[model samples]
Target: MQTQRSFAKQTTGTLYLVPTPIGNLDDMTFRSIKVLQQVDLIAAEDTRNTQRLLKHFQITTRQISFHEHNTQARLPQLIATLNAGQSLAQVSDAGMPSISDPGKELVIAAIKHGIPVVPLPGANAGLTALIASGLAPQPFYFYGFLPRKTQQQVAALAPLKNRTETLIFYEAPHRLLKTLASLSLAFGEDRQIVLARELTKKYESFLRGTLAEAKAWFDQHQPRGEFVLLIAGNPYPQTRADAYQHLNLHDYVAQLVTEGHPAKTAIKMVAKQRQVAKQEVYRAYHQF
Candidate 1:
């Protein structure tokens, strides 16, 4: 393990991770502006988008495109630049670089090569949303984005259902409904969630309610802008109920049904509480 003293004198140039404003231009820190002007080169996720920001800040630093598709081709060039004692700054389209952004690989490369990596604290969508979400703030888990594929997404979310910490997620407008449905299926309809839309912008809004309520709202109102979803953690005890411990899947669902739920609703509830797919619970309840 290598320890880094960010401000210590070093032979090589430093790699500065700069954070841009997520939506509001006023959120851009003075130090970030100074870093952009001072760095020898700016490695941006999208040069065109960075140009617009640079223009706003009157920062004329030259930028090279470094996004997901070109990470490999640009890695060597960037490392060489740092090795040659030319300071570089990396920035994403918005918010902090490397947090659901494109600067992680570069940061890793910089560290591996003994280059100093300095991060300038600035705006972040996740924490910004979390503070006002009315959910448990500390001991939170930031799961940026789930897999796009249905099965993969389900698999990814299943284990998170039992986590007691608040869950944070980033989602696009188009996929918001699908993700809400998946969250409801995995975490149950009663789970509390907050949807922070267009954070820091003029149109910014937050919708706080249960998973079922969020789904119903989006069904009528079109989802607009990017979203930061915060889900309340499992309020129930982590340990399984003693009654459920001795029951099989079919019997478990049947018992819930006998208590007061419809057959389908019981199956869904069992699937969520057990962290299994609804289909598995349905088949077990039907002996199919």
Candidate 2:
């Protein structure tokens, strides 16, 4: 495990994870602004968008474009700058640097190279929406931006259907209605949900109700602005109704084989149901 002493003096320059405002410009923190001005270079997800933020705050520090498309090519250069004792601040269009943002890979590389990473607390849409969401706050699972396709999104939400902790998700305005409908189908119609939109901005609003109500509301109104979807966790006790629930790993595969499934197919199914690595299941099934 890698440990980071954020404030400790380091031989190489520190990588500051600065959080910009999610909506309101006044939400920018003093420390975040200070770091932005002091850093040698700022790596931003969108240069044009970040430029507007920089202009508003009068921060003239040079910015390099470091987004999903260009991360691979830009990573080495950023690392080299850090090694040269030139501090860098990484920022997304809004919120924290790496929460569904474009700084995780770079952060990993920095840590692997023994560079210190310092994160500053600021505006986060997920947490901001959660506190006011009237849902359980602790033990929340931040699942930012689910897959866009309907089938993929449903498959993704299937596993999370049983989680007890509050769930947070981010989605664009265009997909809000479709996502709410999908959430309704996955978690059922009665599940409680809170939709926080345009957070910290003048038009900030929250729509709190059941999943069914949310779907119906968006069906009537055209969704505008970004959304923070806070879903109440599963309230019912988890059921143990699987057909293979009582079977041992080996026996489970054996039973599937007995039922006319190919050995390889049975092994794969067992691995999926048990949530173990396929290789582990394959080894046990073949050897025993």
How do the predictions measure up, each by TM-score?
Answer: 0.83, 0.85
True-structure Cα RMSD, model 2: 5.3
lDDT of 1: 0.92
Taking the tens digit of each residue's C-alpha lDDT, what string does model 2 give over 1-288? 768887788889999999999999999999999999999999999989999999999999999999999989999999999999999999999999889899999999999899999999999999999999999999899999999999888978977888899999999998888898899889999999999999999999999999999888988899999999999988884642274689777778887776578999988888887899888888787774
* Residue pairs in candidate 2 whose N, alpha carbon or C atoms collide under 3 angstroms: none
Candidate 1, position 193, lDDT: 99
Total backbone collisions, model 1: 0
Task: Name the best candidate (by lDDT).
Answer: 1
